[model samples]
Target: MTASALTFDEVRQARVALVGPPNSGKTTLFNTLTGGRQKTANYPGVTVERKSGRLRTPVGRSIELLDLPGSYSLRARSPDEAITRDVVLGRQEWEALPDAMVCVTDATNLGQHLRLFLELRQLGRPLILVLNMMDLAQKRGYQISIEALSRSLGIPVVTTVAMHKNGVQDLLDQIDTLLNQASVTGDGTVTTDAWVEPTPEAIRGYHQEAERLLREAVIEEGVPEQLTRKLDQVLLHPVAGPLILLGILFLMFQAVFSWAEAPMDWIDGGIASLQQWLAAHMQDGLLKSLLVDGIIAGVGGVVIFLPQILILFLFILLLEDFGYMARAAFLMDRLMSAVGLNGRAFIPLLSSFACAIPGIMAARTIAHPLDRLVTILIAPLMTCSARLPVYVLLISAFIPATTVWGGIGLQGLVMFGLYATGIIGALVVAGVLRLTVLRGGRQPLLMELPSYKWPNPANVLLGLLERARIFMRRIGTVILSVLVILWFLSTFPAPPQGATEPDIYYSFAGMIGRGLEPLLAPVGFNWQIAIALVPGLAAREVAVAALGTVYSLSGSEDAVTESLAATLAHDWTLATALALLAWYVFAPQCLATLAAVRRETNSWRWPAFMFIYLMILAYIAAFITYRVALALGGG
Candidate 1:
């Protein structure tokens, strides 16, 4: 078990930089080495930065491992790649110099992967080559002689299958030997012909060295990978690829709608029962109102989204865990490119449909600066789950859930429309931004298509649970706090004594909403909607609960006993419902996304621009929707 040792009590510490070409299993290996204790962050100024973590090997050696962004070579075109190269060469503006480097390479495609291995050597970073993906190499009818290759490269080499944790022991054994000797023996005799500085004269020399090394020791399998080639037939063909992607996306959303309904209904029933029991027992006053209307309705509004969030995460997790996402990125790059967006933007945007925060965070993976910004800016436009509650509320209220086209439901039709609107908006926005603000010439997409595999069940469960936790946390903290204050505002200026029934109209809440009504009238937002928009700033889902309470208070105080579903079904006008749904498509509903823009862009200017532009667009869209529908007589 003493796999590697540089114990404080035993010898010198090791600073290791993990260098790998893109998708060479470096990140998965980092997660395995560091567990869940790592922090992810973008480098200052540039959107993509280095991600590093501290790892203690099994033998108690303290090793600081930096997971550099995947780059094709040390000659970097992006800031992220530059930082990774600088660190390996110990040229960074911060932190102590690294002691050694681990060059992670794909064993199956060594010809394409060893380019980075040679690039790292040019940085003069004392390096060890990790022949990762050996299991995959073996599967493709190839074998590697690790000791002979190590001798040939004149550097320590270890063959590892990082995904399965196989050969990791030997990899560590090599690291310990390399690090131990660097201390006592001054640069281990282990070295590589791969080691050469990248000068105008030497860059080709290093590449030639790699080509030479690849020829003698590495054998071409004589066939393209069968599984990859087969999948790519459907996954990469321009016509077939987009169709397949659309189909997968449709199934994903379809599952979100159907699979989550039963669980949502169960939760809704539970909340209703709890509210009823509390009302029956508690004294009739603010406390009861706070628990039933404020707490149960507000908290329940957000928690009901858990099943849907989990459902979305299920597809995302399966795609990623099965190694299909890389292919997805590759396949979609062409369509995305036509829109002046990077194909890599598609994956991040798809993540945005789940929640914009992670989508924004994932944009760090895009190497192009303008592409990262464009992706981050348009990411929130994707219909997030926050938009889901609003969509479900309106669609379920106005449209029937009955099956259509012998398969899809009418309610599902609205869901599909809402999602389509988001996609169209993202593409249009990316096109505009590319032409105007983050304008740049086209960039070719270069990415590896990982082979497909069955997704791991445990990984799927853990991912779903994590997503669910984030959703609940947002509800409990931000949404709950806002709801309590809304309850305070709406509950006050109690109906005057001897006033006619259903007297919320006479309260301070009505007066405030009525004052704001004229501004929103063109958008089909009634006085009650104007009232809800104040608190809806906290979350898109909260607006659903606001409608639940304000309408209950406005029309029939007795409606506290009825489900909001029943209330909405009976009261809302179809034109009004359609207009409101359109408005939410562009509403700046989540403050968190705005806050993220500030963090990502490092200026109040960009975030402010986001809010201002979205609100203006939302108003214009909503106004046209409302007026057209009203002219058609509320169809």
Candidate 2:
């Protein structure tokens, strides 16, 4: 086929940036417009994530919507805020000058939110002021003059309830109008000079402007709303708040174990049925072994815990949407600051519940370098989702399937204990580091407490689906590869004619595990457990699959298709099980997490130190756990 000259159509898509203070519904608005089409990646040469989505106007005009970090001002503090400032000022060489700026502001906090708008107005960009949470504002009997605000700023004003996608269409229409104006004016090129370096005088003037505009446009009937105020009395009470926070987290873990029982049973039954059918129908061969022993046993062992993982994320995402998560951080701020970190470290540490890499990247929000480093160092101890499979596997295998009063399962209690262990460990380590190395003065906690609202079901569903996709993708790729390699290591070098034990006892993995047994014996690890730990360095979740594979090969031929949990319970002592759990709680992080530390810190020194300290802690903790369990007759 002959190539014709490519017809070039001038793309008039506006480079629109959605900027606002944290928890200002900026991301909700972006998600509302983009739906499922948004992509997440890192900014060039920086670890901070860049999120963008394609938004199409009613008339079919497309615009690139950029979701900038939630920053309070153009005057940069944290790395996230710095990126937002540079991008808005057209100073980031990697980004185009925004053709339009969607300044999302909380309608209830206009006095403060409008400060950003006043600053952005100085840049001379086409600005659309988004007054979000209008429904809540109206419910509280506050009146806002959209027309007056628009006239004062000389820009279109769009009001939205981002959670429910209300007023999103209006925002899109305004964006369309701005893009048309920009194309007509031929001012698509960025104007860096328009943004002068902001000084204290300029910031004060902007705040004054914001206050004046709020006076003119906003009528507050019940200032300092009573609902949040009343709730805060109980939720923020120094003693009550921490107790309630702990109770909530404890209940979450309990729910993860109890509510997920039915689904986990279904998954487990399905796997067992499939394994039995394959074992009976297929002739014994490498193919059958790989399918039953490698794929099903390995991947299925990890996949069985999917329901529990979903439950964990469900609680987190819901709390986040309800705006209670910020409160949890606020409640923990005193404890965090005592360890030489500030309240800003709480969010990143909280993010670690999902993954440490993002949690480490999130440390960019901490202004102090030492505080940020301390947060990154301890982020791995926050019981990330990767550790969920291991926790679920051990708890299921060892803990009894019984419930305490109030219907809390014993298995869930153990799961909660594991998570709590990690949290307490992180705090303890952070405290020690602060005293010895990263000592610094306390930084003031400057944070916005968003008004509480019901979490949108659609958003919750989408968040859960996204988390499931990420987990499943890892299982299919990383877990599958690791399982295959492990299967090979356990299957090679056929047993001698008169072998007395399972063939795996003579395989490469078995020999290596035996070699490490002496070193790990004090912690109650066996040859099989030692072998699993090797591949676990790639991903913590892989340890569960590795155990499944190792035990599958170690079992007698007649029991090849037995459940991994059943096999574990039958072969492992209670002390060993608990020690293994303790080991995982403090184990050196996976290679990916270590690599992230290296990249974030710009050196091998931190990652090396992290591995050493974590390993030492893991060993000591495991040794202690093993000894105590033995004394308690768990052995």
Model 1 lDDT per residue over 1-635, tens place: 36443355344457787889876878767766666555544566655545677776656677778888777777776666777766665566664567788989888778777777776665554779998878878877885666667778788888887766555877776776667766665654433334344577666776677777877786445345777678788787878887887899889988987899899889878877887788789999888888887778778766777787778778988998788788788877777898888877877888888788778867876778788888888898899887876776678667876997898878878887887887798788888988998888777787666767667565466556656666676677767777787777777778888865344465566677788899988787878788767667767877766666566542221243246657766776777888888888887887768877787778898889888878887888788888888889885
lDDT of 1: 0.74
- The C-alpha stretches of model 2 lying farther than 4 A from their native spots are 1-12, 91-94, 139-143, 161-166, 193-197, 218-224, 274-288, 344-367, 383-421, 493-497, 521-526, 539-581, 595-604, 624-635
Task: Tell me the lDDT of model 1 at 541.
Answer: 77
For model 2, residues 197-309, the per-residue Cα lDDT tens digits are 68889888988998888888886643657777788899989889999998997798678768988997788778878888999999999999889877887777667768877
In candidate 1, how many Å is residue 495 off?
A: 7.4
lDDT score, residue 28, model 2? 76
Residue-pair clashes per prediction, in order, are 5, 0
Name the TM-score of candidate 2: 0.84
**Each model's TM-score?**
0.83, 0.84
